[model samples]
Target: MGRKEDQDKVQSVLELLKKQAPLTLKQEKFCNKACVERFLKAKGDSVKKAAKQLRNCLSWRDSIGTDNLIADEFSAELAEGIAYVAGHDDELRPVMIFRIKQDYQKNNSQKLFTRLLVFTLEVAIQTMAKNVDQFVLLLDASFFRSASAFMNMLLSTLKIISDYYPGRVHKAFIIDPPSMFSYLWKGMKPFIEYSQLVLVVSSLDFEESFEFNDYTSYPRVTSLRFDPSSIPSTKLGPCSSSRFSFTVSHSCDSVKPWYLSLTDTSASKVGPTNSSQISLGPVISPLNARSQSFASPIDRGLRRNDNFIRKGFFPSTPMPQKTQSLDPSMIHHPRTPKPSFLQSPALFFRKDYQVSRVEKSRDSFQSFLKFYRRPYDEMIYRSKMKPPLGGLISIVSPQLKRRHMSISQRF
Candidate 1:
């Protein structure tokens, strides 16, 4: 149903397809004005390019038997729902999700995975009704451990969809790409049209890009009503609620942490004990249990003493019984003097102390350390060197002595 002015342009492409492809009964029945227009647009309205694209599509159908792809025969495999034609976007374009981990082949062969993928996509293409020619794809790569396992499969799929199935994807949303994607995408991106593909890094990004209310408010171009119930329950995205958000609010509690699978081959290492013969403590008598609750040194003065306890330089905790049990003579011993040094600036810059700060502050400090490693290392080494610098500065510049001492001690 194109405008009157577009009839000749459409007919020109149709004549080219007839000459190049020579449609059979099935191809002739499949040929439609809308489908033909998509080919023309995909090839930038060039009859030669459009004919070539259409010819490739015909060849692909012949080789793959796309007409024979039925969902019923693959029900057992499809029950796992590796890929499916689910709801439609605001434009009535079909939405499909490709989950890598759920669909990973047990034999770990890319061939089997590709067959399943192509079958699912073919089934999805069949769901394209009337003038709706394209589908939206949501690629869930969150569970994929490495891109090397599926990079080639992804490339091949993209090639098939772009070359043989031109203009079949209105928009594609790729979700939760593995850490390796940043490196692999550099090469794969050039082949993909950026206008149709969106690499979503997080749920927040997904919500920002697409939402249900967006298309609802805009004036309707056709008589398409979005049926909420038609959308399947999706765990991979945040659109579960009515908000039309794609935030990742839910996780499968039954599945263990992904890293647990990457552990040592020997599978007998689950425990709280030091089963690997790793010694964790010196086992000094438990004088007191230091409360792990940590805050600023000023706010938790007594708690700061754990720094000394960790190094076995001071009693773990000053319980009433242990303090009373100490011999009267040893109570005031010069060597056992209270670790007044706990308040010294030297305690502030210790790696352990810095890492124990509030979570945000600790993360910021750690990130800073990554960029300023050389300066930080030199300062820390200078700080640990005692006597010469600490005392010499105290004597040479008495007025600036405290500032120098604090900076040196903390470093």
Candidate 2:
């Protein structure tokens, strides 16, 4: 059929599902029109068959508690590392990588394995970008060798994906597959059409294409230096907050400043509402201001009068009101004290000998750079076994020795 006819068929199937299929409100919201199209396409455009398929899927999902599987299955760290949601392909489709370890075995029931697969697929589906609902499955089968039961479980999981999760995985990349995997691939090859499966004998191409190591299989989602939004903290394992290199966003509501108690207003009133009008006082100096009196307070019998202090510092002539305003350039503010570092005048001056030392260091560094830029063959005149130390004595002049001594002393 043509594309338009197929779309009409899908629409008809969706209408039929709404009328006949038994689906909950949650299922109806989760399963969009594109999902019904998948069911119709999987069942050969037969409305009754597609409706039945969707109803069975809904019933199975409800029975197995598929919603809680993501939360419960991630407790297994190995499983999380084995199958994770990588960043994306060039086409912007979500890429899900699954690698089976060589020593891994199914000790539990098949139900657990199935649930894990379902949970992984759901995560990939949820993480897909806008206008892109398909996924590319990158399977590493290097370690999955000579295990018939494990192979059966894998094929069965593929079968479930093909039957229920239609149109989800559009491409499959098999990496470092052994010769035995060809038989398995040939058996299930006919179920999916318009889907391509590539078997790679060498993992080099896979690593280059996806930018991941074969053994480590680190996730590309968080591996990029720029992008930090894809991978969750759970998948990376328990990372301490102190060790994280990226900035974490947090609300300032619970964070109280160190000077909050010293402010004039209560901390509750210091919210964002009064942010425009609040003014902070200058920092107080711990050193006491020098008293004018050289004698101790005990030696002074009576308190000094204000006129006695003014008469000693000010002139007796009547001052104009404008002059009494006090020029800021002449009078220093007693409220703000200078720190000890800025109080010394010697710290601000640069000596001429220090300038000469800096110039000498720069010239030496430039000479070193010029020597470093020369080719190795040009830099080394000839290859010598062990006589270079004795020959260096001929070129060692008194000026060179003095320069060496000066350089050592400067360092």
TM-score of 2: 0.46
Error of 2 at 88 (Å): 0.9
Q: Candidate 2 — which pairs collide?
A: none
Cα lDDT of model 1 by residue, 1-411, tens digit: 557656777787778878664788988766677777788887787777876777777886777665554444444445555555554555666566676583455545655555566665655555556767787766767767777655655666677777766778765655566678768777667767533354433443333332233343323422266665778986554232221223443554635422211122223222223434324332111221223254334333332245643234355885565534556776664565576647768667778744553343333323222121111122222222233222343235435534346666888
lDDT for each candidate structure: 0.54, 0.53
lDDT of 1 at 60: 67
Off by over 4 Å in 1: 1-5, 102-115, 125-131, 194-196, 204-411
TM-score of every prediction relative to native: 0.48, 0.46
